[model samples]
Every structure is written in C-alpha cells, then in structure tokens.
Target chain A: MTDLYGVVPEPLAFAARDWGDLAELMERSSSDLGGQGVGALAPSVQAAASAFLTAWAGYAGESAAIARGFSSALDALVADATHTDDAIDTHFGGIDARLGPAR
Target chain B: MTVTIEVPASQPTIRRPEGQPGGSDTLAETLYTAASRYEEFADEADQLLAPRGFSGQGQNAYQAAGGKAAGEHRAMATTVERVARAVTAYADTLRDLLREWQELSDRQDVLDDRRTALIADINATTDATEAQIAALRERASALAADYAELVTDHDGLHRRVRANEDLLRQVFESATSLDEALSADGGVPEFAQQAMDRPGAPGSGATPEETRAWWEDLSEAEREAVVSSYPGLVGSADGLPADARDQANRVLLDDDLATLGSKADDGLITPAEQKVLDNARAAQQAMADADSFEDPITGERPGGQLWLYDPSAFDGDGRVAVAVGDLDTADDVAVFTPGITTEMSDVPGYTDQMQNLYESTRYNGDGSSVATMFWLGYNTPEGAIDWDTMTEGRAADGGERLADAVDGLRASRPDDPAHMTAIGHSYGSTTTSYAAADHDLDVDDVALIGSPGAGPADHASDFSVGQEHVYVGRDSRDFVAVLGDEGWIGKGGLGLGTDPSSEDFDATRFESEREDRGSTRLDGDAHSSYLAHDTESLYNLGLIVDGHGDQVNTASQSYDPWYDVPQDPEWDRDPSSGVPGQSQTRDPGQP
Candidate 1:
C-alpha cells in the first residue's frame, strides 16, 4: 500500500540512487576525456583556450557537488520519517570531490 | 512559401574558406557527450520529484524547506541541461558552417569546369548548324544562372549563422544569471565584494601609475576574481603586468573569435561592426602567430599583449596595439605605424616585419632585451577615395593618439624608460610628424621611410628629436613620396609638405633604392620594400632604433633648383628624370 500523507523511503531511496548515478557520470565524463578534449581544441584557438575549459569544469564540478548535497539530504529525510511505513536510516557515502581547472 | 532576398549576382563571390582550424570534430564530440550527461541530470531529477514523490506529498509538504529546496534543485538541473544543449548546438553549428563552405566551394569548381567546356563547344560550333550554336548558347546561360544562385546561397548563410550566434549568446546569459542567483543565496561569494571597490578595477579610469599601484595591492584571490570577471578591462590596462594582461586579453580575444568570427570570412558585417571585427581578428592572429616565437637573444617565448583594443575607434576604422616583447623594461623599443589602408588586421604581418627589425637591432646593439610594438591606433586613410573625402583629418587624429600612447608608455615605466624610437612609413610619416610638431611626441629618434611630406614640421628642427636624430629614406622611383614636393601637388596644405629628403629640409638621407622598381604606381614593390631583410634601409633603421645612429651609411639628399634661383620658389622635378639603379655592393651581403 502506498501512503500519500507524508515523506517515504521508496522515492527517497530512488532519488539517492539516481543522484549517485549523476555524480558518477559527471566524474567519469570529466576524468576520461575532459583534458584530452580541451587540449585537442586548444591549439586551434591559439591563445587562452583554458577559459573555455574552466567554464565547463566549473559547471560539471558544481553540478556534481549540488547533486551530492541533495542525495545526502534525501537520506536524512528518509530517516526523519521514523514512525511512517517507509523508515530506513541510511547514509550513502560521498563521492570523491576533485576541484581544479580542467587541464 | 519562402521569401528570398536578391543578392547581387555581379560579385560572384564563391571561394573555399582557408585556414580551417584543426580539432573541431573532437570538441563537438565532447560537447555531445556532456549534453547527454546534463540531460540525465534533468531527467532523473524530474522523475523522483514528481507529485507522487516525497516532496509533493501532504498539505504540509508545500511548507517544508526540503520540498522547496528540491524544487530549486530541479529547476537548476533543467536550466543546466539547456546550457548543455545550447553549447552543443553551437558546436554543431560550427561544423555545419564549415561543411556548407566546402560544399558550395566544390560546386563552384564544377561550374568552372562546365563553363570551360561550354566555351570550347561554342568555338567548335563553327562547322555546325544554327541549332547546334543555339544549344551551346543555352548551355552558357544555364551555367551563368547556376553561379548566380550559388553566390546568393553563400550570402544567405552568413546572415543565418549570425542569427544562430545571437541565440547562443542569450542562452549563455540565462544560464549565467540562474547560476549566480542560486550560488549567491546558497553561500557567501567566493571573494569579498568590498575589495573590488578600489582603483584599477574595471571602469576605475585611473592613470597607469595609480592603476599599477592599486593592482599590486590586491590579494591573489581578488586579482583572480578581477581577471575572470572583467577580462577586457583588465587585459587592456597599461599598468597591469605583461603576463597577466596577456592571459586576460587571450580570454577576451578567444571569446570574440568564438562569438563573432563566423560571419567575418565572407565580409558579412555592417560597416561599423566590420571595423570592430577586423581589429579583433588582428589581435587574435597576432597573438596566435606570436605563440611560435622564441627570442634569439633570450630563449623566452611570450604571447603578444593587447595594449590597446578600441574597436570602432576611428569612425568605424578600429584601433589595436600589440607588443611582442616585455615593454615594461627593455634596452630598446620601436613603435611602428603603417600607411594608407592599414588597420589592425594587417598588424600581424607588420608584427613579423618588426621581429626582423628586432633581430637586426639585437645583432648590432649591446646585448640586452629589445621589444618591438605594432601600433595601428588610428583610422588610416584608405586609398584615393578616402584621400579625396578626408585626407589630412585622419592623420591629424592619429597624431594625437600616438602622442597619448607614448605618454602612457612613459607613465607605466617611470623609473626605467627604454630607448624608444618612432617609425612611420609613407603616409604614416606625416601622421608621426604631426605628433612631434603638435602633440610634442617624446621619443629618442624618428624614422620616416618613403615619406611624401612631414606635415607641419617641414624642417627637422621643428621636431622634438632634433635634426641630428631625424632620418629619412626615399626610393627615387616611388612617385607617391614625391607628393610632398610643393610643385607636384601644389602649394600650402594642398599636398603633405616639404620632402624630408630634399636638401633644404636637411634630414639624414638613407639609401632605400630596391632592385626592382615597378613601372607603375600600382606596382608598389619598391615603395613598400624598405622593411625587407638584408636591405640598406632596414639595416640603417636597425641602427637608428638601436641608438647607433652615427654608424649608418649616409646618402646625399636630392637637390632642388629652387635654391639656385635668388628669389626662390617651390621647384618641380620631372618624375622620369632620376638616376638608374646604382649597385652599392652588387648583391654583396651588407652585414
């Protein structure tokens, strides 16, 4: 049976999983071809192609950071619905954060 | 139904785009990959945040901070996805434009071949019936119509690309605003806002010394914030360090290339905007080319610094100044201004020529760092049309700008001012002369090559450099340089002024005759060959720029018969009556 009156663990759990997936994707995409991609395009531009990379890096890093924050909060919300039908005190581990200008 | 604007078919402007940048395909792939991730971000956020989800629950759910925060998060994710889409579209547009250029260019090649064959068919029709000749003529008409339509398509694409760029700019703005709002409310700004209130920050309008002092006082974080936020202002400031300015200007320049360079290849801008684009491209290419330099004296390879970047400065002519070496502290410096029709777009070529001048100066002078700067900080008169419309007005304005530049250079390096030389070629010499005469241009020496006249300062004594330091070079065959003589263009303000190489004017004359003087004025091979390597004029110029003016081999000034008459008048010399080319060394190396 589904309870429509309050917060539940089913969706929170799903949200946490999906948010973790987003973080994983962001990190993987950034780590794999971020530098090589920007480097290949750098010489064609000639001067200061680093700024374009910086803009991309900031967006990726910041979005990943925001997603982690929400995921952690959702887990805490699941724990707060103690007496409800969906009560699961869970703590998803954080993703390793890397913050630097994309090389 | 589509409305088509009739593009003038007379121009027949179809050519392959040259210098296509490498590695765009890799970037487009990267953008596609990134866009997919962003889409995932938005899609996942939407599914979990639906009405049946935790945030969209009971009556109290609307009052919950968690629910509200979740809404904001969802909004940001969607907005970011749009940013990703916009960037991806931008990348795709670039590739598509390149394809369009190439395909149309190939079509032109085919059309050209058909036209050639049609001509042969018409010629071979001499032995055929009236029907055969009619068929050949129809073929010619078909080919002509094909070419006209192709030109129209080329013109239409430029406008369409500009429209795409305009949309991309708006998307970027929306994303930036959304990010700033979310991030600012979530946490404190990264750097203190109070630190930016001082001078030398963008729009401070402070003097170079004050700007430098203020910049030196800023913290590392504050400096970074300023550079990232207001790159154009920071990059163009004279007081900032060379490397810092270079880094900032490169970012600004790259932005210009990405946003505005697409429609520039086929000349698809308004007259006012065209100047701005030309100047930006000039600065862009100069820095791009400077990436290849490794100083012969010192192994340092520094990118060019954009000292002045005022696009649309001279009634839409634009202005830009680029420095190849460290101008702050050097043993020698030369600020070169080019002649008629020259603009920032031509400065990269001049930058290369100036590099040669630097090499010769370094070889002859005492071992020290030498810097050469290319200054196109004026609206140069453009050939006969501009000459007729407003000739002296532009040069006079250029003179004022040149004076201010030298003043700023001095102010920026008060303690260790380098030995500076002012060099002007052809009409630029008149511009330089007005700087010295009217604005009191401060320099150690002045060099005028192929000068028609020296403006108001006809006598060398009228200049700040004094007669001993003023040098002149004239190829006798360069008829344009003869415009300064009173008899050629006739009296007071009608022409430029007295020829700097005339005996009466008394400036040190240098040998500038080239092996090949073109038969006509349009063939200006000798007129513009003063800067060529291994030439006497270039070596003499190097000596003057290096402060070894006494060492240059002098040539006799042209004699004027006006002095022979007791009651002297502006004398005329026949243009055809000049000595044939003299072999000073008969191709022997000057060095």
Candidate 2:
C-alpha cells in the first residue's frame, strides 16, 4: 500500500524571499521615520515618511484587491463566465508581475 | 475291545450341509470317535509299561507301573471332555452367523422399497411438467389470437381517423371562410345579394374563397342569420383535427393495452407480468413521491425528524434535507455517496442505482430489515482548483454530521443489531474516505466507484471494520481513470488511482464486462456506469452488499455456473488477477 499522507512540495525559496522583502521594507520605513522629533524633523525626512506610508498603503490595498479579485475570477471561471481571463490577468497573474520586481 | 469293534463297523460318514447346523452334529460324532480311540491307545501304552505283574517284581517298580496306568486313564477322560466342548462352541458360532445374515436381508428389503417409491415420484414429476408445458402452449396461442384482434382493431381506428381528417379539414375551411367574410361590415341587402351570387359559399359548399366572397356580399341581417344557423358546424370544424387525432390515438393505444392485459390475465405470463407491473407501479410511486419533498411552502413531509446530516455542514431544519427510504426500520443500513457535485436532488435517482445491491441483501425480499440512504448531506464544492481542497469545510462538516447521525441511530436503536455499508461514487468516495478516516464509525463495508483521488490512509483503524477492506470498482472504459497516475496532479480528477481498481492498489476488484471499445466487453461511457453492468460490477456489488466476500470472485478470478471455472483464454490474466494498470506505475506511497 502506498503512503496515504503525502504532501505536495512547496517552493520554500520563493516564500522566504517574499517574507524577506516585506521585512526589509518594514525596517527601512520604521528607521527613516523613527529618529526625528515631530516638530524638528526635516521636510525631506517628513516627506520620506509620507512617501513610505503612501507606498505601503497602496501596496497593502493592491494586495487585498488582488486576493479578492482572484477569488471572484476563480468563481467566474467555475461558473463559465466570459470575463474569466481578464479577471485572472488583473488579479493573480498581474500581481506577481507588478509586485515581485518592486519587492 | 468293544469300542474297537464299534469303530470297525465303518461308522456312517457324518456329512454337514454348507449352511446348516449339521456341522455341529458332525463335529460331535467325530469327537466321540476320537475320544474312544484315545482311550484305547492309552490302555495299550499302560500295559506295555506295566507288563501285567511287574508291580509284584519289585516294590519301586510295582509303584511306578501303577502310577503310569492311573495317569493314562485320567488323560483319556480329559480328552473326551475337551472334544465335547469344541462341538458346543461350533454350534454357537453357526447360530450367530445366521442371525446376522437375516438382519442384513431386512435392511436390503427396505432400501429396495424406497428405491421403487423414488422412481414413481420421478415419473409423477415428469407428468406434471408435461401438463404445465401444454398449458403454456395454449396460453401462447390465446395471446397470439388476442394480438391479432388488437392489430385489426388498431387498423380500423386508423381508418376512421383518416376519414375524420377529411371532414375536419372541410369544416375548418368552411368556418374560416365564413369568419373572413364576417370581417367586413356590409351594406346589408346589397352585400347579401352579391355574397349569394358568388359560388362556393359555406352553405353552397364551394371553394372557401368563393364562399367568403358570397358571404361578403351578404346584408348584416343575412350574415347574422348565416352565423346563427351554422354555429355548431363552425365549432366542430375548428376543433376537428386535434379532437379527432386525440380520440383516435387514445382508442388505438387503449386497444393494444387491453390486449396485453388480457394476455397477462390468461395465465400465459401472469406471474411475471404481475411482477413487472408491480415494479413499474413502485417506480412510478417512488418517482411521484420523490419530487414531493415537502412543498417548502407547506412543510408537509411526514415524520418530521432529522434522519440525515453532514457533520461539518449546515442542516436544513424546516426544509427537506433528504428523501429517505427503508432507514426508519431497525435493520441493515446502506449509505450511498455520489462523487463530484452531489446534492439532495441526487437522492431521488439513487434508489435505482442500488437496485442490484438492495436485491442481493439478506433482508431484500422481506423489506423490513434492509434500509438504504443516499447521503447527499455533504456540501462538496461545485468546482475545485485543487481536488483535495475543493470542499474543505464542507467535507469536514459532512464527516462530523455523519458521525452524529451514526451515534444518534445507535443510541435510539440500541437493542437492534445494525450493520452499515457505505458506498461512494466518484468524488463522493473521497468524501466518504475522509469521513471514515476522521471519525470512528460502525461501517461494515466501504465501496468506492469511479474514484480518482486518495482513499483512507491516515486512519489505519478505519478499514478494520468487518474484516473486509474497502472495495473498489472501476471499468476500463471509465474516461476518468485515463488520467495518468500521479495521484491527480494540479487539478484533481475523479480520485481514480487510489482505488482498489488500480493494479497495485490491492483490494478486491470487480472488472466489468460492459465494453466501451473494440470487440471487448465494456461500456465505453465514462465514470457514469460503474454499477451498471449485470454480470461483472453489479454482480460483485450484490455480493458485497450481502456480505459474501468469501464467495466473490474478484477481478482476477472467474466463475462459471456450468463449469468449475471459466475457460475463456483471458480468464487467468483478466484484471482480477492483480495485474497493475498498463500505463501507470505502482506507487505504494499514495493511498
């Protein structure tokens, strides 16, 4: 009899890289914003913090949107909806292409 | 001297018959002669040793001579006594042999009598069979006559329908023309004159166009008069073709039905037809009652109770969750799981699918101790990205729900012995395998049909129920099985390779003779027909349901009613022989 509890292999390297990228971004954003007092902080430092916040917010929003979009796309594909390809491209397919390089 | 003299007379020869007591008499005579001869011999020897007056010659010699003479006399007496006892013993032996022979003869007589009676019984049976055959012939003749009458009646009805068609067409033409004529509002008297002058009017019985023209020329009062006069004819014409066809077809069909009914009534095939009719009636009733799952509006399903549930899923409280049959009884329970996209609607047709299994069950004909349930309470995903994770929560919930149902049944029917058989088809098999693995169940048999993914591997103890391992049925024609065996990579197909039908999977295999290709015996249709074949899959399934594992011949084995084993050249190498799939490798690592 074959072993019943076999698990499919996952890409550990890819997963580690994703976590590493997110961790580096979090660290850099925190350090750039943490050192200055609220009133004394230079305009550039303040601007950098704002830019980091905006970028983080946009990335988070896009990540969430992509997950939801992929789910809807999968549902449509199951239901044989015509918009399946577009949904897949904009969500799951487009996500790695848009975010992987940036990360 | 006197004994010697008597012997000299040449005693009449003593003779004994082969089986008479004379043998004892002969022995007695012989013993008497022998005794006398021995006495004479001893007396002569004594004289030789003693020499008449030797005792007087010397004191010691005289004593020795007296002692020898006295010993001779005693020896002679003992010999005579021994011969007499021998004669008596011979007589007893003869008597016992005679008694034994008589007893055997008596037993032989009784056996002969029984043999005679058996011959007579066989003759009687032959006579009865001949009479039955004659009656059957008569009934067949009657059926032929009735069929001929029905055909003639059908022909006559068709002729009437044809004739009616012409009349109906004529009426339709007349009425349609009249209606067209009435379409125009007329200058009463002038129109009436012009309509009357035209030929082929409805009353004139001419062409419909001419009839319309004549009616159009009629005055208003004249048109009304014409309409009123022919209202009945107009109505008849309008309804003619449909009414006539319906009437004719009904008449002919009824005639044929009557002939068939009479054939059944005449005892030609009364019993068989009655059985078929009963089955048809039951099927009809089941079909009718099936759709009647409590009008969601009325909540009218009887015996409002939770008979079925999926542990990890939602249960319909007020609505009908399942259509149940035979489950209310305290007997054997069979739960059927339909793979891939099974819902409550699948329950209705499931009864037909399991007819063979149900028929072979021990309590089949009795209908009291056998119960079957189509367990569609699980919420399996309609589609899946990965086969295993498709109905993740739904499958877990179903397992839990089934556990609860089993528990509840056991508690309520504690006194009655319950045996449960679980049958899964397609994806349903996976769900069942999961349920059994996750929970401790009282299931006796688990059968998977058209399975694609893994089976029960985690719970080593799950299949230990009832000593029989899970049974798997797969046909070569099943297209789902064609998915090469990597245990369904990427998108999971029907869990085909994990089942017993796989060459290395090692379970009892029931290979179907229903061919789907070439000259081979297998129905080509995919995963749909695992239990459909008669001799192969269906027969083995029935055996499983009846718990007759030892009697079953798995895919590699062959059974022939007339011979000890099937003689087909492929019999030995057939799929039942544990031959692994031709295209797939045996991977013991996967379930």
Candidate 3:
C-alpha cells in the first residue's frame, strides 16, 4: 500500500501478460464452441442452444474487454516506468559525459 | 377405410459421436481450463490493484482498470463454469443414451430367443387343444405388443438425446451469435483487412520483425477475427507467429478437406483437385499426429504448428513445414530439410523426428527455448535409383527456398535472434549444403546427416558460416552417405560434391552410430537413424543446435576409399592434410 519499494510493476506486468494470454484462450474457446457443429443435437435443439450460447458469449466478450483493459493499463504502467528510467538515464549520461571520466 | 400398420421386427439404431470424436473440440475440460485461467488471472491482477499498489498516474490507471477487469473476470469465470457444466450434462446424457440403446438392443435379442422357443414348443406339441393354441396366439400377440412398446421407447430415447443435446447446443449457439455480433462490429482490424487486400504493413515487403511487432500490437479478439477471415493467406504467410499460423492452417486444412471432399463426392473433382484433396488429408493427419504426440523424453505434449502448409505445391507433390515448438520465441531453432522421395505424406514421420531433435537440443542446452521444423519445401528427387538423383537442379532450387525460410526465421525476431541450425538428412543434407554455399543460408550452424553430397560445395569452407561451424554425421554402415564422394575427380556440390563427413571436407565430424540396427543398409535404415532417440548422433545434433558444437562427441573421419581400397580412419591418417584450425574435435565417443 505504501509503495516504498515500488515493487508493484513486476507483478502487474505478470498479471497483464497472463490476462493477455487468457483473453486469447477465451476468444478461441468461444469461437470453437460457436462455430463447431454439434452433430448430436437436433436443428431445433441447436437453435435453442445458440440463443443460450449468445448470451454467454456476450458476457465472455465483456469479460475479455475488461481483461484487455487491465492488460493495456499495465502495459502503460510499464511503458511509463521505462520512459521515466530512460529520461533519468539520459540526464545522468549527459552529466557523466560532461564529467568526462573525472567522477 | 381404415389404415393398418404392422409392428416392425427389430428396433432401428441411431448413431452419434462417442467419447470425443476426431477433430471435435467440444471437451468440457477445455472450457473448465478457460474458467480456471480466468480465475487465476483475475486473482493475480486484483491482488495488487485492489489495494492501489502503484504510485502516481500508474496507480490511478491500474486502480481504474482493476475494478471492471475483476468483475468481468469473475463473470467470465462463472460463465465458462456454467458452460462447462452444461457440456458435462450433455456428455452425461450421451453416455446414458448409449447405455439405454444397448439395453433395448439386448432386450430385442432376448425377445427373439423367446419367440423361437415358443415356436419350437408349438411345433413339438402334436396333440394340443384348440384352447391351448388360442392361448399361445394370445401370448404371441402380447410378445408382439411388448416389442412394439420397446420400439416406441427406443425412438423416444433417441428423441430425448436430441432434446438434451439441443439444450446444450442452445447455450453454445447463444454465445456464438453474440460473438458473431461482436466480430461484426469492427472485430476485423483495419490493418489486417488492408494486409489481406494488399500485401503491405508487416507482410509483403516488411521484415519478419516488423510483421511480428505489427501482429503483437493487435488485440486478441482482433487477431482471431483477422485469422478467421483470411485463414488461407495467414496460414501460409511467412514471418508470422507460429501458433497463429497453426490455428489458421488447421482451419484452412479443414476447409480444404471439406470443399474437396464435397466436390469429389459430387463427381466434379478434377485430377489436380483430387491431388490437392489427398495432400490436404496428409496435412490433416500430420496435424492430428502432432496433436496426439507425447514427448517421450520430456513427457510433455509440445503439440505441432503447421508453420507452412500448401496442399498443392511442387507439381502436386505438395509442400509443408511443421514446427514442434514456438518459433517466434525459441532461443534455438533448426530448419530440417529432408532429401529424396520426401512428400506431403512423409511430414508426420518427419515432424516426430524434429521433436526428437528438439528434445535432444533442449536436453543438451541450459533449458533454453528450442523449435525444430520438419521442412519439405522443395521438389525432391522422385527415386534414389533414378537419373534425377544424380543432378544438382533440384537441390539448387530447394537451396534457395531453404535460404528464404532461414532468413525469414531470422527476420521474424531480429531483436533476440535464435541460434539457427540448418539440417539436411540424406539428399536433404545435400540440399542444405547447397543452400549454405549458394543461397547464403542465414544460420549460425549447419549440420548434414547421411548426406549424399553437398551440391557445388567442395568443402565446408564454401559455406558462408565458415568451415568451423559445419557439422557432418554419417554412420559407417550408411552406404548412402558415400554417394556424395567426389571420387578422385572434382565434379560438383550436389551429385558430384565431396563427402561432408570425410577428412578432405574438413567439417566438424561427429560420431553417429554405425551399429547395423537395420536389416540392411540398402533399405536406408542406417541412413535414417541420425536423429534417433538416445543416440550419439542425435546427442551431437542437440549439442550443435544448443550452440555447444565444441562439446560434441566427435567421430574419426571416414573417407571414401581410394578407388575402392579401404582407407585409414582419421586417427591413422595424417591429420595435417585437411583439419581446419577452428574445429576442436571431441575425442571419439567423448561427451
């Protein structure tokens, strides 16, 4: 909570990566379930199944969007950290160059 | 005017998919895993975010992201969990129906037996009364009624099974329709659409790194949408992600199979189309084999990717490349090209060997990433004994394609490059050697096993990677390995090239087994055992692919005899004649 050590980014990054991977899996599973022909079911039954599945897919899609949002947010966090670090390094590098092997 | 209907003698059986039919991915377990992943992923994301773990803008952003993600993930988990439950229910019903069917079928058998017995008894009773005969007729009618009832029940159960499946199908279909709507509303990324329409931005002229970066930038849904829409192009496109290609190619393979099968069924298939169908079937089998493969060494299922698939390439012989691991991220990658008589059907067998090689490399390395590809991307010689085998034309053409594949791999992930190894077996070795020599094959190492000859390459020095990085493996008993021998005369690299494993060629020679494991060397068993599991040759290949070629157990150089006379091995021969300075050969049989 205090963020003294600033250790949130690593876990955050991991979560983002996992979320991204999970989203892909969800999408593939959703597609497969929807597209694959369930040969055992009757046409009428299949139609009924479709209506039920569409509602589920909609929910899944919403969930996927949320996961993606989390991933993107974490990506931004990482990118910011990198940018801040790069800026600091650039400033220090200039100083070091000006110092010219003195310190 | 009443209509009369008679009771049928036996019940008609209904057929359905049993116990996870082939190519059907309706396993409840899959959805269960999705749900599980969501739970885990959500927990991890929420662990920090709920407490505002970050500082400044990042913290605020994460806090905002977490609230909705956590809720959605929870909802997704629940959704998939319910879906899984529904699937389980359907499966249970299916199993129950099967048992019910069996029971009814068994009853029919029993009824037939009873009917036969009753007939026999009536025939034997010569002095039976009219009353007894009438009673027997009633009993027979009762049996018929019972059979009629069973038939009705059987039909009812069949309908019940359908009804049950329909319920589950409805759930699936509902999700499908929603997904379709989502996709319809800008699911297909405009960049992908552009790529399909005109080969620009990451594919046509862009480097593989460019392609990968562009691909990685897209959202998961967008990626799926794009792949689903243009499976044919994306499936075969070079420099893309291996898994994505695998997915697209599988879909493409199925579509091709279905389309071609339909045409042939209607008697509208042409000869060329028939060939395409056969090749597609072969590719499908390869994918299935990859799917079912259990790595013997690792006990891991490193399933295959149809990295490249063309059902009708090379004059209907077909061309295909299968990768056993993730090519986009592997630290070590080997592109193995096979030699004479290789075709689409040969892919399944080759992919297994590639996996073996992949495992061997990983075993030898420090547990880094490795992907091995079984590449049959050339028009190979049709027969070993044919006049075509004695020419460099096929190898020359194959060499260029081999170079492109290697280059594509290099370009795909230029930021962190894989230690690429190009391997050719039998005539494939010759083709690989030519690729290295002529096409400037971009790889860190080149390994040739049981090579007939290096097309146009007289020595390892001809390769751009330098003579030191070249490796050769030929079992002494492998007769085909000697076909590359440039007998006392300078002929050429392919048909007339020097033996890669010989002292004169001066490549890094490793001991591959010469044990007569095969019934005869002429059958090519000896020639084909280079990548066999747990063997020295395979071990050396692993070491080389792992970038530890110096640690390989080197074998004594075996040279072509001077006009059929047996020559001394590398130990007895004057080693100063051909040994290069950079190659540090391991002691014979040394690890």
lDDT of 3 at B442: 92
TM-score, chain A, candidate 2: 0.34
Ranking by TM-score: 1, 3, 2
Question: Where is the poorest 10-residue window by lDDT in model 2 chain B?
Answer: B1-10
Give the runs in model 3 whose Cα sits over 4 Å from its true position: A1-103, B1-192, B195-210, B216-219, B265-268, B295-298, B385-388, B490-494, B517-524, B560-591
lDDT of each: 0.62, 0.40, 0.67
* Cα misplacement distance, residue A93 of candidate 3 (Å): 99
lDDT of 1 by residue, B1-591 (tens): 222222223335754332223454445344435544554555556555553445434324423533554555445444433333333334444455668987888888788788777766655544666676567657766877898888798886665455444444443443454454244221112342344577555457887778777777976545544554455677677667655565555545544454334333323334555667677777777776666666655657744566766666667666777777777777788888778888667868987787767766765566767777888888788784565313577778888888877876766677788898999888888889889878988899999888878887868888888889899887766666666753333444535787887776788877666555555555657678777766667777878888877777677777545445211111122221112222221123323
Individual DockQ of the candidates? Answer: 0.13, 0.00, 0.13
TM-score of chain A of 1: 0.61
- Give the range of the ten consecutive residues with the poorest summed lDDT in model 1 chain B: B566-575
Alpha carbon lDDT at B495, candidate 3: 45
- Model 1: docking quality category: incorrect
Candidate 1 lands at a TM-score of: 0.55
RMSD of each predicted structure:
24.7, 55.4, 23.7
Q: CAPRI band of model 2? A: incorrect
Measured with C-alpha atoms, the lDDT of residue B497 in candidate 1 is 80
